[model samples]
Target: MQPWFVYRKCSNRSCDMCIYFLVLFASVCLQVQIKREKALDITSEHLIKAMADQMANEGWRELGYVYLSIDDCWTKKQRDPNGRLEPDPDRFPSGIKALADYVHSRGLKLGIYSDMGNYTCGGYPGTTLDTIKTDAETFSSWEVDMLKFDGCYSNDTEKAIGYPKMSSALNATGRQILYSCSWPAYEGGLPPKVNYTQLGNICNMWRNYGDIQDSWASVLDIIKWYAVNQDVLQPTAGPGHWNDPDMLITGDFGLSYEQSKAQLAIWAILAAPLIMSNDLRTISQEAKDLLQNRLLIYINQDSLGIQGRQIMKVDCLGVWKRELVNGQYAIAVINMGDDGLPRPFTTSLGLLNVTQCPVGYKLYDVFDRNYLGLFNSETTFNLKINPSGVVMLFIQPASVVNHMKRHGSYFG
Candidate 1:
């Protein structure tokens, strides 16, 4: 998934303005929503309200707030008279519209979930070919800013028809609602059926993998999938269309502090969406530290829009690298093994994928938040990686870093 970029203010009159416009388009159109998935099975109006407020106030890097998303179980068992879906009255006492107003009051958008089948994955009534348009209208009327269209009880052909149909229906509403399609994942992620180009035209982001549970095993599973399939899948992701490895589970209970940092590093290296899936109000300070890591956030939000890849992996130890927008790189050294103690892992600049950066690179340790002098091509840097842990480095050519210091700025 590693790709290089050459972005600068175009001075040549002969340059194709279309290329710059496409980059700007991806930057604006693709990242239209600030999304956060509600904690699974425990979603409610009060919970969403609290999390939304927290997202706005917490020291979240770059994108300060998020669209509060209700996953499943928010809707009633069936629809109302106008064929519009209804929220569970008890769970959503003020209703979705009123809750939406409250969220908007804080400058946050509200997102709702749905399936393109007879029933939602949570067994709530989902929209079919018959009700998709009406449902889209209903969401717009209620001030929903994002729609996560899932596939559960539908076949592949049904998915191809219904998912895009829903996108069209949403567009017809004359509301700029962000559409997140789950079609590629249902088709096992990209072959003859999953068209990445069309998905980009339709969705702000699409899931092309399994849901991430809160466990080291789940984290490794996703990392492995990306590592094995990045060549085919990485090019498919950019600003507006992302290969979602699912939500960030850092602030949740399943992963240890070290393991949580690993997940964050890998996700940021991949430039994946930063949709949190944990309960913000109840998260620990350690988890919050990982979630709000400034360096990691900068990497994920880089406009370069290139996902990183594992350049080398041996015996569960690996190195992942991504090119930065400012002609630098973000490198991650991962230790996925079950070593009882710190394992010595090492690599050098020459081994990394990109050929632009010559020899010596000034590096910043993302987790430690400190400068690591200078690492040249011949220098074999060694890191004692803990079990299931990662060491993330933001790397830059020494000349560029020195220039930044002279100008009182730092490379991302």
Candidate 2:
């Protein structure tokens, strides 16, 4: 089922730039309402616990989905008289510090959200230029491991100054907060318009596109944008600095089972952050299984950290490749069509610019969890991909494949 959407009128003193935040507010509310239905009045605190317990017990945390982020609207509508951000009394009576402690106790990290303007997108209190230091210290004191600093109710010049200043403020706190910036997404996520080198210096990851909605169309739109801008986005992404395509809406109302798998596969291939924005308590078993896919998660967390690039696109089918540690690669063939049938296609590694290995590479299916055998660069891989689905393979050199099999470690 889809979540109810909320629309809050822009009530901040900032200029007309707030209209942009109102739109983002309405979209993010969809995901928030879904979680609310799962936990009712104890939504904020109990929901975090539920997510933490699930992540720990269900093997998701071990698979590298560590951070449980609290998004907009978690704060009070107005700051305390001392100009400090406070958790909403009605929603989070135990407060954000207690929540962060609980998350850390579960061997997980906590991420909180705020804006770089007078108010958050959800109309909650935000950090202005004068209050940046206070908010940064508050987050550190609460033991917040990450901060998703959003762009709302502010202009370009304010963003340019505020983003860097906030980074400095965060560093001064002497806490290791993973800064997720929205500055570039507001500036069109490209060079001249977006200074990625500056972003890399400030943010650990940055959103590069519109917020993802819970639908196959929304997923397709994001993938298409990344493909179109691959040359620009790919090089800028690496170990600590990543190009976020927004959250994983898998197991939510919008995508089919195939589409859910496709989303997880492609997100891993892109080396994007695997932040799930769905209700964990009610997710379907199929969706749960896909979220916990070990091979896919391993490929995503590869030490190489190179972002994948789209190699070919033919009508409904598109192929992408990411270089991995130990000379391996992750290749994804996605079908983004709606013809209601799986499309059969063929391709070779040579066409993907993969040079011949001393011994042919072994093709292992990430979702199916089966080895498709060794193939040289000239060998054609015939594949049938479901509409709005994907076929993800890990290409490992024979030497490493033999060593992994010998040690009984397949996804290593």
Candidate 3:
């Protein structure tokens, strides 16, 4: 069999064989160890501090969030005289390293943004092909924990070359930095030129679609796109690699309380990254509660790491189910309508594609944090879904450890 390594002169046959096995081992088992991203937009230091505080202290860290990322516009309009990217002196009074230190002090990692072209999306300096390695070193020097590399202002050829080159440069830094790319998104998210396998090997997580504005319409569009294309998207996400659905707008305006819940619940079900991007300090208490929902976070962080799919959708009612690490399932009953009234919906084990869903599952309501009681395969589960809301549940199978077995219906 051909070796996985690039051609290199072997010192000896044993050395060559050793190199081959090591490369093979890494190819098979070394995942990037990056699975979450909480992307922030260009903002002042105070706002970034607030987001870091919320993510670290307000119950999101325990949910497996690893990086608190800053998106575009963190830098000045031009590189410094030394050809190094510099943070806006006024916005970041303490500099990028200081901000990174603050985030680290809060028990969180810091992420900064860059573009593969001449300028970032916000018209700030970028890490174009000429500066890719320098930019990588700059981020590493700043002790940045992650990078959200955008594909703005570049031709297809430039992106195809620059994106991978940047990834290589990052690896060469010898620092444990996660790479989040917009390459696949610029390539239109699939097929012809999009190579998911290579992406998994290169990028830790990648934006697969458009940016999410702070609105329900944008959220709905992303959901719809993922639902239809999950066949190609789901298999590509797990552990170190993921399909980013952009930042979470849970605590932001443009979505009602119920609509925010839908966004959070659907994101959890999709096993997507929990990168929240909102004004955390000024966010409503209700939005904060939903954004930091423990059950939803647990489902999102489930080690099974399976992205959910829209198994059933009729009109505005839909069901999305994600297999969890515990042999249970995280399911979301979503109402897509805005009729200003609650809608009653129903589904069974078969409809959920659970096939032979056992009778001992203790379906717990994730939103209400109450037991919905045990159910059987033939059980008819009903939910009163609010308009543009979701009822996410964790149907935990009765285990020998929990001893929740009661072979029949057990309603509250």
What's each prediction's TM-score?
0.86, 0.89, 0.84
Whole-model lDDT values for every prediction: 0.72, 0.78, 0.72
Model 1 lDDT tens row, 94-129 = 898998898888767777888988888767798898
lDDT of 1: 0.72
Residue 135 lDDT in candidate 1: 94
- Model 2: lDDT equals 0.78
For model 3, residues 6-85, the per-residue Cα lDDT tens digits are 21112211111111100000000111343322122234676678777776676556545546676666677778998999
**Clash count, one per candidate:** 2, 0, 1
lDDT of 3 at 102: 93
Model 3: CA > 4 A from native: 1-42, 54-57, 355-359, 403-412
Between candidates 2 and 3, name the one with more favorable lDDT: 2
The lowest-lDDT stretch of 10 consecutive residues in candidate 1 is 20-29
